[model samples]
Target: MPKWPDDDVILFDGVCIFCSRWVRFIAKRDTAKRFRFTPIQSDYGARLARTFGIDPNDPDTNAVVHRGEAFLQSDAALTVLSHLPGWSWTRALLAVPKPLRNAVYGLIARNRYRIFGKYDACFVPDADLRARVIE
Candidate 1:
């Protein structure tokens, strides 16, 4: 079981450049310690994905499970941002059509490695942040 609270967990693509940066971004400001994370590439992530009917092999699909309900991709990102402090204001982006939002998200994701950056391994949260990794 995840050490972090189950309802606040977010499972992401560990290998994706965008996802890795996102993990760091989220870790920096979760001041209230209200969120948790893991890579969809992990065993727990795989199980959670299956529970939500998400395809494990699809890197474009992101997942956020809250109270047993799951959000996907753009929805997942919006769901996460909704709970974040300053970022919560961006939840309005969720009102945009999924296809449109995902199209933009996809463009970035497709070129994430080139546009952003990547890491050789999953992030290991520091002593204070370790609880947020959910592993």
Candidate 2:
């Protein structure tokens, strides 16, 4: 696996439209380029998933690795948001309780395909952002 330059990495389901959109959203606001991205289907992503004890082939959750720790599902999203400018406020939702946040995250993850759709192929970052992706 390639060594990721950034300390923060986002592992997402590349084939899921919603997940891809979420990644794009973060990329746009990441002024400091603090995050690196990888698709769960990629070799590196698969390795990381297995290392993290998640199903590599049928990943139902996204992850954010920050400061050498991994955060999953709702926690992952909030963690990413917390590091972005002006978005740290979203992390306050953590006060709502983990179980509740995960329940909502699970609902969306389970129905993401039906609601947001899926791609036949994994996402490909554009030229300017290609280096930021590890697929």
Candidate 3:
């Protein structure tokens, strides 16, 4: 479990090639203004990840926090889908099989940097997106 989150929080790898793309993608779909993001390498992200038993130096994939619990990998993806307007219905359908969902997610996470490319340093939030970050 995690501390109660006042809003949706995404904990991700800032330097990962695939993670960066997802951050940008989610930012674009945040019309309802319900989510926030931070890189696991950042101080804020590190603190949060540790609270949930995640390694800051190296993380498997994205983590989503709501209430006081942290959801990882495919479950995190499903949570995000359920919250975002366009994908809510699909989120419901995807919830049927957790093990299978994570197996696929894990495969991608294991090969992410190689397939998706990586950044030398964690991403830095721009002025416009800074407000969407906590700490």
Best by lDDT: 2
Q: Tens digits of per-residue lDDT for model 2 on 47-123?
A: 88877777988888999888787888899999999899999899789899999999999999999999999999997
Order of models, best TM-score first: 2, 3, 1
lDDT of candidate 3 over 1-135, digit per residue (tens):
647454489988888988888887888887877889888887888988888888887788789886667889898888887787787786765757888889999999989999999899977777767788775
RMSD to the hidden true structure, all candidates: 3.8, 2.9, 1.6
Model 3 misplaced regions, further than 4 Å? none
Clashes of 2: 0
Cα distance off (Å), candidate 3, residue 109: 0.6
In candidate 2, which residue pairs clash?
none
- Better model by TM-score: candidate 1 vs candidate 3: 3
TM-score of each: 0.80, 0.93, 0.90
Best by TM-score: 2
lDDT tens digits by residue: candidate 1, 10-111: 888777777877877877777787767878778888777777766666766777776657777788788888887898788889789989998987787678
Q: Cα deviation of 82 in candidate 2 (Å)?
A: 1.1
Candidate structures ordered by lDDT, highest first: 2, 3, 1
Name the lDDT value of residue 128 in candidate 2.
61
